[model samples]
Target: MCCALAVPLPVGTAAAIDDQQFNELKDLVTKLGQKIEKQDLRIEQLEKTHAQDAQVHAQDQKTHEQDQRKIQELQQKLEETQQAVSNVQTAAIAVPVEPLPRVPLDEATVNHNFSILGDAEFQYAKTSGQHGTFLFADFAPIFLYRGGEKVLFEAGFDFGLQNNAPNSPGATTTINLSFAQLDYLMNDYVTLVAGDMVLPLGTYSERTAGWLNKIPDDPLPRDLLPGAGVGAQLRGAVPLGESGKLINYSVWGVNGASSADGTGNADQLDLGGNVGLRSDNAVANLHGKPSGGARVGWFMPFKPHYDLELGLSGQSGEWDNAGQHLWSAGVLDASLHLGSTVEVKGEYIRSCYGSDDHGNVRPEGWWLQASYKLVGLNLDWPVINNLELVNRYDSIHDGLGTRTRRYTLGYIYYFSNTLLFEGGYEFLHSNDPTQKDQLIFQLSYGF
Candidate 1:
C-alpha cells in the first residue's frame, strides 16, 4: 500500500510540475508576441517620418529653383533696362545744334573803329577896316586804343568873302585850310607829332590858334613869330632835384612855309625847341596836374600875325633872286603862374633877314602881357558853364612898325568844358592910322 501511494503521488507531482512549466512558456511567448507587434509599429512610424522628410526636402528644392528663376528673370530685366538707359543716353547725345563761328577783326575795322567829331562857326562882323561875314570851322577827332595810347587829329577850314575895297574888286570868297596835324602820345613823359604844329617860340604863339585865343587880335610878339609850320616834334619831361620839380622840353624840325602853302623845296628846314620848368605839384586849370618847371624857347623865320612875312628866307643852292631865301630869327619867352587864376608872361625877339638886296637886316621887338582870371564863378543856368572875367594889357614896339598899345575886355560863355562861345571888345591905338580900332567875335568848340 505504501509503494502504490508513493508512485501515484510522484506521477501527480510530475504532471503538475509539467503543467506549470507549460503555462510559464505560454506566458513568455505571449509577452514576446506583444513586444514584436510594438516593434513593428515603431518601424512603420520611422518609415512615415522618413517619407515626410523627403517630401519637405523636395518642396524646399522646388522653392529654391523658383527663387533662382526669379533671380535670373530680374537679372535679365536689369540687363535690358541697362541697355535701354544706354540707348536713351546715346539718343540724347545725337541731337543736332547750330554752331557759331568765331570771327577775326579786320584792318578796316581797326582803322575805322573810332569815331570822328568836330565843330564849325560862322561869324558876321562889321569893323573899321574889315567888314564881312566869315565862316570858320575846327575839327578835332580823338582816337583811343586798348593799350592806353592816344592820337588827336585836328583840322580847320576858313571861308569868307573879303572886300577890303568895295569898288576895287567884287568881294572874293576864299577857303583856307588853317591847321592839320596828328599828335601821337608815346607816354605822359614823351610825345611824337607831325604836320602843321604850332610854333614853340613863345607862350603866346603856342596858344594863339585862331579858333582858341583869349584875345581877338594876337599879341604883337606872336604876330612876329612864326605861328604854324609842317613839322615833326618830340617832347619829353625830365625830373629835376627833389624839390618836386621837372622840366619839359620840346624839339622840332619843320618846313619854313605853311603846310598848305608849302614850297616844292623839300630841303628847307626850320629848327625850334622849347624848355619849361615848374615846381612840384603844379596844377593847370585846363590841363589838370602839370610838370613844374621854368620854360624857355627859340624859333626862326619870324612874321606878322597873318599874311605878313618880313624875314629873309633863302635856300642853300642858289642866289641872285633865283634860289630860296635864307632867314634866321631868335626868340625868348618866360612865363609863371602863381596859381591857377594868375599868370604873368613876357617875351623878347631878335631877328635878322638876309636878302638879295640887303645882306642882313637886324630887327628887334618885344611885348609884355599880364592877365588875371576870376575863375570861381558859379551861375544858375547851364547857359553859363563857367564864366571867366579876364583883364589884359599889352604893349609892343617893332623896328619896322610903330609902337602899339592895346586893352581888351573879354567874356566867355561855356556850354560845356569843351564847347565855348567867346566875344570880345578890343581898343587899339597904333602909331599907324590904318590899323586903329578893332572889334571881334568868335565861337569855338573842342573835344
Candidate 2:
C-alpha cells in the first residue's frame, strides 16, 4: 500500500490539490454562505420597511379624514351663521317707523263764519184731556265765530210755525234774534261780552247756549231765565295749585227787568258769577288718564233754592203802568265721567218775580234731567258693532202753571263713532187745560 501510494499520483491532480486550491475552495464556500445569510436579512428588512410604511400611510389617511370632517363642519357652521345674519338684516329692513303727532290749527289764521242747522219735528198725540195732531217746525240758524283777539260775533234767528190752523194766522209765528252779541276775549283769563249776550245765571244759559237741542232740550227756567240780553261778562279760570285745582268764574252785568225779551230799556244792570274747581290724575301724575271738575254759581236775583242769584230791580221802560217787581234766579250744575263708557250730569235752577206784579207774574220754576250710555256690542259677524241705549227723565214746575213730568226711552245704532241713528219715544203729563200729553220722535245727525 506504501509503494502504490508513492508511485501512482498524477502530476496535475496533485498540483490541483495544493494549499492554494484548498484555501480558494474554503473562501468560496464561506462567501456563498455569507451571501445566503445577507439575502435572508435583506428580505426581513424589506418586510419590516413595508409594514412601517403601511402604518405611516394609514395614520396620514386618518389625519386627512379628520381634517376633512373638521373643514366640512366649519363650512356648515359658517353657512348657518350667514343665514342667521341674513335673516336679521331682512327683519331690520321690514319694520316700519311710527308717525309724529299732528300740530293744532293756528287761531290767528282761523276764519269766523256762521252755519245753519235746524230740524222740524212732527207730533201725533191723543191725550186724556185733548186729542189732536200738531205739526211744528223750528228753524234756528246761528252765527258765531272768533274774530281776532278782542272781537267775536254771535247772532241767531228763531222761527216757529204751528200747523194747527189752515186759515187762521198761524199761532203768531214769533221771529226774533235769539242772541246778538260781540264778545271781547280780553285775555286768556277774562272776556267781555256785550249786546244781546247770554246771562251768566244758569249753566244751560251760558255753557250750552251756543248749541241748543244738540243735547236734551231744557224748559222753563232753562228756556226763559233771561237767555239773551244787553250784558257784559267776564269769564276766566284761576289756578289754586299745580295739582290741577282750578276756580272757574263768570261775572256778568246784565239789564235787570228792562232786558226782558229784548223789548225794554237797557238801564238797570244785574250782576252774576260762577266758581268751579277742577282736578285730574292725568295732569297731576302726567299719566294722561281721564279727569273731572265741578262748578257753582251766584246771581243778583234772589230766588229760593237758587244759590246763583239774589237781586232787586225796578223797571221804568215798558211797565210804567205796571207796578215794579222784584226778580231773582240761580243755578247749580255738575258733570262727571268714568272711563269711556260712563258719564254723570246734573243741574237745577229757579227764578222768581215778586207778588207786586199782576197774575202774569209767576213764582220760582225749575227743571232737571240725566242720561247714561253703554258702548260696543258684538253680534254675529258684523251686524251689531257699536250700539247704545239711553234713558232720561225730566220734570218741571212753574208757580204760575202746572207741574210737568216726562219719560224718554231711546236707542242709537252707530255705523261709526261719528255717525249714528237715534230714535226715541217721549211720554208727557201735565195738569194744564192748554197743555196736552204728546209723543215725540226725532232723528239727529252730528259730527
Candidate 3:
C-alpha cells in the first residue's frame, strides 16, 4: 500500500544521458539480479546440508544411548557371575575331604640290622742305643649283630705283624680273637654276657684297647691281668637318682689262670694260656677251678663332660696244675674330668701268685695320666686347638727281681675326631739293663 513519486531530471542531467548509455546501465542491473539469485540458491543448499547433518547426529546419539545401556547390562551380569564364583569358592573351602589310607611301617630286617666298627694303628719306636724301627701294624675289627630286640652278638679280632724274636730278621703275623660274646638284655638294668668276654678287670683292657691307648703301648701293670676270659658275665648299671649319677657293676665266672707248661714254676706263669688245649690232650681247665671276679663303679656327673668315677675290682682262682696254688688280683681305678679340657685317670694294680720256687710272689704297679686340650684357650686357631698335651708316670715291679719306673710326655694332633697322630718321649728308670729310654710315634684311626 506504499506509493513512490518519480520527479523529472534537471535540464543539465537530462542532456547528459544518451540512448546507448541507458541500454548499458539496464544490462548491468540484469547481471546483478542474476548474481543475487545464485547467492540465495547457495544459502538454501547450505541449510539443507545442515539439516541432514543434524538428523545424522540425532541417530548417532540414539545409537550411543543404546550401546551405553547394553554396556551397563553386561557389567551387571559380570558382577553377578563374579559373586556366584566367589560363593562357589567359599563353599568349596568349607567342604571336608576324606583322608587317604595309612600304610603300616615294617619291622627292621636282619640283613640291615647289624653294624661293623673298629680301629687300626701303626707305630714307630726307638729305644736308647737302638735303631728306630716300625714297631707294629695292628688292625682290629669289631662285628656287631642284632639278633633280636633283646639279643645281640659281638666279636672282635686283632691282626698284627710283629717280630718273631727280639732281634729277628723277619716278621710274624698273628691273628687273635680279641673277644666274642653274646649279650642278652635281661631287663632295663641287667645284661647277661657269654663266651670269651672282655673281663672288667680294671677297664684298661676294655677301654684302652688298640688306638684307644693315648700312648703307643699299654700301661706296664696291665700285663698282669687277662685281657679276656672265657666266661659268663652279668653286667648292669643302676641309676642313683635323677641327678645324672649312677652305679655300674659286673660279675663273672671264668676259666682262671693255668700253668704255661703244666708246672707250678712262678717264672713260667701265663695269664692267657688257660684257653687252649694242653700237651696232655686235655681240653679242660688245668686248675680245675672256675675263677670269680666282680667290679663295682660309682659315677658322678656334675654337668655334661664333667664327672668323677671310682671303681674297685678283684678276682681270685687256683692257677696251678696241682690245684694247690692260687692267684689273686685287685685293682683300684679313678678318673676325673674337669671339663672337655682336663682329664686325669689312674689305676693301682696288685697281684699275688702262689708258686713253688718263689713262695707267694707279688707283682704290683700304678700309673697316673693326665691330658689337657689346647682348645680350652679358645685361641681360634685350628691347628693349635686340635692339640692335646699328655703326661704319665708309671711304675712296675716284676714278680722276679726287676723294678722299673717311667715318665712320658706326649702330644696328640688330631686330624679329625677319629684320626690322631701321637708322639711321646719316655724317661726310664729301672734296675734291669734291658730297660731304656725311648721315643715313640703312633698314627691311630678309629671308626
The sequence of per-residue lDDT tens digits that candidate 2 reaches over residues 1-447 is 898778876778888679788899999999999999999999999999999999999999999999999999999999999999999999988988677896766666767443444333333434445555544434566666766546778787776765546876546676767778887877777766666666555455554442234232445445435555454666666665554445566655544342222221222212211101113222121111111112333232122322232222111112211324434555556544444444344456555444332433443444444334443232454544455565656666766556776666655555655344455556677785565544443343332
TM-score of every model versus the real structure = 0.50, 0.53, 0.74
RMSD of 2: 20.1
**Backbone clash tally for model 1?**
13
Output the better candidate (1/2) by TM-score. Answer: 2
Error of 1 at 441 (Å): 3.5
Best by lDDT: 3
lDDT by residue (282-321, candidate 3, tens digit) is 6778777888999999999999999999999999999988
Q: Would you list the rank order by TM-score, best first?
A: 3, 2, 1
Model 1 lDDT, residue 220, Cα: 60
lDDT for every model?
Answer: 0.54, 0.51, 0.90
| Model 1: per-residue Cα lDDT over 1-447, one tens digit each | 888776645567788999999999999999999999999999999999999999999999999999999999999999999999999999888987667895655534455445444444444444677765554433333333322236656665555555657669565666665556777788888888777666565555445445455544466644444655555777766665554355656666554421112232222222221111123443211111111112333222122211111111111111112234443456666555555555555566765444434444455666555555445344455544366554456666554456777777776666666666666666777887776565556677664
Better of 2 and 3 by TM-score: 3
The best-first sequence of candidates by lDDT reads 3, 1, 2
The global Cα lDDT (0 to 1) of model 2 is 0.51
Candidate 3 has its poorest 10 consecutive residues by lDDT at: 1-10
